[model samples]
Target: MTDPQIERKLIEIMRIINESDRPVGARIIADELRNRGYNLGERAVRYHLRILDERGFTEKHGYTGRSITLKGKDELEEALIGDRLDFVITRIEDLIYRTDYDPVKKQGNVIVNVSYVDKDDFEKTAGLMRGAVDYSISPRVGVFEEDSEDIFVPAGKVGIATVCSITFDGILLRHGIPVKPNFGGILSVENNEPVVFKDLISYRGTSIDPIKIFLMRQSTSVTGLLQSGSGTILANMRSIPQSAVGDASLLFQQLHESDIGGLLAMDNESGNVLGAPVDVGLSGIVVSAGVNALAVVEEYGIDVTTRPVSTIMDYGTMKTL
Candidate 1:
């Protein structure tokens, strides 16, 4: 097998190409290596490029240049997460604290506070909580609609929304209940009835409140690329909801048919898409964030999560937020 260090260098090259948002030549890449203090030669760079092409990480653009493939983007994402992967793996070390009080009912409840990295970390941690907690759990992802005061899901129970921050060590720090709201309420899902503040608490302070708190960690990384502008991309295969699979598949098809030139498929339940096999007639892939569906655009190979806006009608009142 190739040396792991060489693999890392190749991944760095892929990242630079992807970030550039356009094709690049080896001379530029060689110069970049020189600036980084690496004593690599043009021939060495070409060798690595050939290996990447063979592995489907990159492809020749036309005659003289090359660009990143969908597989390249996926590999680069994994590579960038080096060391940071601990943030996700060490989630077990995180903790969620809970307490509750029912002043009006003359009974106390439980409130669970999860300490984690940030909003994304909070969401991933919530997924972990679903498995840890004995009670039934549901996970949802979306931004609060404009003009809406709160995030809501029809017929769903409200739970505590913890504010999370990231430590330099990649630990997720969470601050629980009494979360301040600007216009909308806390991050709890809204039901038909107003999702009152107390609703977000874990327990009503009755008896030793049965509420439980759990924590899961999310890992994020920010790495520089050569020509591509700076941006954020979420990588995971399990986070995709089962209910959204069809939409996700259709979005993949749309992307494959577009000018971006790439393919996408559900790699696993985590919402991560492995590099899809595509004809060599197309360009490379670029993966990024989206809405309800994981979108794979062709030519550019941009993977975006987006729900078909038209699919909104298929949803029932029970599904509306």
Candidate 2:
């Protein structure tokens, strides 16, 4: 086998072993490999198994079979990193399908972004978050202290779960409207109103979260917006079918009245929204990014670790911050 082919086969074998509940034998490994269209014979499987053992990527259990080691798992993840380039958009779609939040009835789970800050900075973090320039999904937030298990809070760190704007997509899906997230951008704001997009990262093209990249660069001026009503803030652009425009508008109004509003602007008639063009037959929408509040905290020079579009949480657990 060529070098590349050898690596691929070894990685596949490790994956099979990692997925099995018990030690996996060469015969089963060969069968599983065949199911994946590898066409590897039992002899080839045993040859790869020996290579894996020599590399300390697998362990022999006397007569049982072989199991993947921690080193093997690490290697697998590194090898498959290229396959995860579209992980962000994939995760968002999955969450959208899982979203069951209802605006009118006000129940069910919604998606949220999780951030961790030092416990010593918790009070200050809350204060900064409260000044998010009104670009967040909603005023509701979930706070998990150091000892809380609802979400992982590292030692001496407090976890803050902020409402993700993707909740809008989920809500719309529940109402028969499909949403396609296009990109995340730094939206210019003037006099507390959204203007043009200053910079954008296509959701379909990147591996890392765009908002996280922006925050790390300190590229957002959320504090400026809060103080002077003009600056750049994180925002996401999405599209819906033009046929659903009217119904979507009414539903968004109901959402606002229900205090779950996040819709910033919708452009169906013009097909141009803040300098970003919408495709034909689709209406463009710009919604507030969920991690904007966390960005506010970061702006204050307080350290924060953010995980955007992180998890689903019960709506009832969130309270006004």
10 residues in a row with least lDDT, candidate 2: 146-155
Candidate 1, 1-321: lDDT as tens digits: 888668756865775567454576676666545433345677888888899999998989875578898888887766645433332222212211121222223222211121112333334433443332211111222232212222211111222222111110011012111111101001111221111121121122211111111001111111111113221222111123344445444534442332111121233342222332222222212122111011111112222211111011000111111
Candidate 2, RMSD to the unseen true structure: 8.7
The residue-by-residue lDDT of candidate 2 on 96-174, one tens digit each, is 8888988778788988888888889999888888877377888889998755646545557788888888888888898
Q: List ranges where model 1 is wrong by over 4 Å.
A: 83-321
Per-prediction count of colliding residue pairs? 52, 0
For every candidate in turn, the CA RMSD to the true structure comes to: 23.4, 8.7
lDDT of each: 0.31, 0.82
Best by lDDT: 2
Clashes of 2: 0
Best by TM-score: 2
